[model samples]
Target: MKIELLAPTSAALPTLVVAAGERASVRFLEFFASAIRNPHTRRAYARAAGDFLAWCAGAGASSITAVQPLHVASWVELQTQTHSAPTVKQRLAAIRHLFDWLVTGQIVPHNPAASVRGPSHTTNKGKTPVLDATEARQLLDSIDVSTPIGLRDRALIALMVFSFARIGAALAMRGEDVYVQQRRLWVRLREKGGKTHAMPCHHTLEAYLHAYLEGTGIADDPRGPLFRTVARGTGQLSDTPLPQANAYAMVRRRAFVAGIGTKIGNHTFRATGITAYLKNGGTLENAAAMANHASTRTTQLYDRRRDEISLDEVERILV
Candidate 1:
C-alpha cells in the first residue's frame, strides 16, 4: 500500500532511524499515514509514538525490535504520574496500535505494548465547560453584529449550539452546506468519517445564519468556506477558513466581554444545548440522535440537566 508520507523526522517520529532502523522506518511511516484517517488523531498518535520511541532510545534500547513489554509498561507508568488517566490511556493506545501495525508488517516479532495496560479511568460526565441557558443567550446577544466578523462569530457559535456539532465539523462547512429546504434553513455537516448529517436550523440559528450570509455578501459563493477568518487589519472576511486556535481565542475574548465567569470554550455550546434540550422534556434517545452520538452513553456525558437538579436540592438547606 503506497501512501504519500512526510519524512519520519517531519512526522515527529524522529527516532525511527535510531530505534526502528531504515527498513522498519518505512513500515512505521505507513502505520500513521494509512492507518489513521482523522488528522487530529493522526497528529496525536504520531506525537505519542514519537515520545515512546524517543524514550526507548534514551534508555539504550538499540532498536524498535529490542523494545519489550517491560519498556512499554515502564513508559505507561511514568505517563500516568504526569498525565490524566484519559491522556495516558490514549498515549498507550497509540503505542499499542503502532506496535500492532509493525508486528503485522514483520518489523517486530510481537506487539510489546499489547501486554502493557493503560491507566484506568471512568466518568459519567465530560469535562467540557458548559454555559446555562441564560448565559448562552447573553453571550449571543452581546455580539456587536454591526461588523462582518461579529456576524460570523455569532453564526459559528450558534451553529455549534443548535446543531450539537463538533467544532472541527462546524468549521469544515462550505457555503452550500447551509441552504433552504422545505422552506426552512437546514445545515449539512460533514461529520467525522465523512458522514453527512442534515438538520433543520433552529429558529434563532436561522436568523443568525441569514444575517451572517446577507451581511457578509458571501452567500453567492457557495463553493467558498462558510466561516472565514477576517483579514489582518482589513476587518473583512478572508477566503481562508478560520483556524480552530483562532476560534478558541475569539471565544475567550467574547466570553470576557460578556461578563461570563464560567470558563467556556468552543465545545461549551454543544453541551449547553444538549443539557437544555434534555431539561425541556427531551428524551435521551432523541438527544443522542440529535447530537449524532453513536450511543446514548456518549450523549449522557453532555447531559448536565442533573446538575441543575442537584443545585436546586442543595439550595433547600435553609440555614
Candidate 2:
C-alpha cells in the first residue's frame, strides 16, 4: 500500500503522515537527501539501493530490520560475478551507506553490510586503450571532407584527439566556447567536477573546424550546441545537439570504415592524446591538468612509458 503526497505552490513544504504499520521504518527521504551531493551520484546510488530493495522483497525480507549479513554477502557475490570490480564496489558502498543510516536512525539493530566485503581490487592498474598517431591519421584520412557530414565527422574527431575531451564534455560544448583571436582558435571547456579549462586549438584542428563550420552553416549562437546532427537525408544541419552515445557510435563507425581493428571510443582519443603528448616530451603535470585529473597518478596511467624504451640505445651503450 503506497500513498502519494502533494504540496501546494505557495506552501513552504509538504506534510508527512506515516500510517501505524509503517511507523518503525527509517526516514528514507531525509536519508537520500543527506547521502547524495550530486544529482548523478544520487541517481546511481538510488538505482543501486532499488536493486537491493527488490532483492530483499523477493527474499521475504520486506523491511530493513529483517536484513542480515548473509543476504548482503550473497548480493555482493552475485554483483561481483555479473559486473566489473569498480561497479560492484560502488554498489556495495551504496548498500553499506544505506544500512549505516538505518542503524544510526535506530530503525535497524545492526548494519548487515558492515561485515560484507566488496569485490577485490587485485587488478587495480589502469590499462586504458589508445590509438597511435599513425592509426589516428588513418582515421582522419578515411573521412571524405567534400560532404557536409564527412567534414563534421572530421572536425569532431580532430577535437577529440587534440583537445582530449571526454565524450560528455565534447557533447556539452556550445558554439560560443570557440573563440578566434589573431587567427588562432581557442576553446573553453567545462570539465568534470564542474571545473573549466581553456585550451588552444591546434592548426590541424583549426582548419578542420573552419571547414566544418563553413560547410554546415552553423550560426554564431553562443547558446547553441557546437556539434549538431547533420541531416544527410535532408542535406541540412540538425538543430539538436549530439548526445554522448551518438559520439561513441560515430567513433565506432569511423573505426570500422577506417579498417582500424581497435576498440576505439571517445576515451581512446583522450588516452591517445595524453600518451602522444607525453611521448613528444610533455610533462605529466601538464597532461594531468589538461585531462582534469585531480592527481598525477591518474594521469600517469595513460602515460605508457614502457612502449618508449629504445632497444638500439640500450644496445649501443659503451659502458
Candidate 3:
C-alpha cells in the first residue's frame, strides 16, 4: 500500500514515517514528489532523508514526530566522521529541507534539523581533471569518423570542449537544439535551474556537428534526442537518449585507446575548455558568460592557469 503511494516519487516511506499514520505517509511522499524539481537532487535528498529516519528508528524514536534535534545532530556528526564536509553538508541540507516540508504539511510540529550545524569547507578550485590542448586535439583526431558511432562520439566531445557545456545540459538537447543563427551553427543547452543557454559553434565544432547530424541522419527527426544509444545488435542509432553513465564509459574507453593517461570524466572537457580559453586570452567574465555561470568566482574554479605556475615554481626547489 505504501509502495503504491510512493511509486511516483520513487522513495519508500521510512519505518518511522509509516508508523506515524496515513497522513504523515502521504505527506512524506508528497514532499519528494512535489517539492523537488531536479531528479538527481530528489534522489539524493530522498536517500538522505531515509537514512536519517532509519537511524532515528534504531535510536528508539517511536514515530516520525519523535525525532529530535539530538538525533539530527548525532547523525550529522556521524556523517562527518565517514564523509567529506561537502557531502555531509548536503545530507544535512536534505534533512533540514525534508523537515521543513513536513512542518508545512502539519505532519511535524517543528523541523528537528533546524538547529543542527554542518561542517565548514571551502575551495577555490574544482577537482575535475583537465586535458591540455594537444591532448584534447589528439583524442578528437584519434577517433575514426567513418562510422556513425564515431561521428557521434567526436561531435559530443567537441561540443563539451568547444561550448563549455555541462553533460546534463548537452545530453538533454534534442535534434532541434542544433540550429542555425545568423549564418552560424548554434547549440542550445538547458542548464541547471531551467536556464536555457545558447552558444554559437566554433568552426571546428561546426564541422563535427554537421558530420554527425548528416552522417547519422538524425537531423530528419528534430524532435528526437540529439545523442542516442546504439540499437542492440544493429550497430545503428536508437531513439533512446544516451545515458550519462554510457557517455562516461565512452570517454574512458576513448582516452585509453588514444594512450592518454589522465583519469577523466564527462566534466573534464568543460574545465579543459575553460582553461584553454583562459590561456588563449579569454577574460574570466567572458568565460563565465559563455559557460553560463552566474558569477566569475564559479568560473575561476575551472581556470587552471595557476597549475602551470605552481609546477614551474616547484622545479625551482631543485630537490
Where model 1 places Cα greater than 4 Å from the true spot, the runs are 1-4, 7-13, 16-20
Q: What is the per-residue lDDT of model 2 for residues 146-182, given as tens digits with 9 covering 90 to 100?
A: 8777887888888878887777787778888878877
Q: Write the per-residue lDDT of candidate 3 for residues 72-130, one digit (tens) a residue.
A: 99999999999999999999999999899989999999999999989999999999999
TM-score of each: 0.95, 0.80, 0.95
lDDT of 3 at 63: 96
- Looking at candidate 1, the ten consecutive residues that score lowest on lDDT are 1-10
Clash pairs, candidate 3, are: none
Residue runs of model 2 more than 4 Å from their true location after superposition = 1-43, 100-111, 122-127, 181-183, 305-319
The per-candidate count of clashes, in order, stands at 1, 0, 0
The model with the greater lDDT, 2 or 3, is 3
Quote model 3's TM-score.
0.95
Q: Which candidate is the best by lDDT?
A: 3
Per-residue CA lDDT of model 1 for 59-148, tens digit only, reads 888888999999999999899889999999999999889888988899989999887888779999999999999999999999999999
Score candidate 1 by TM-score against the native.
0.95
Worst 10 residues of 2 by lDDT: 12-21
Q: What ordering of candidates by TM-score runs from best to worst?
A: 3, 1, 2
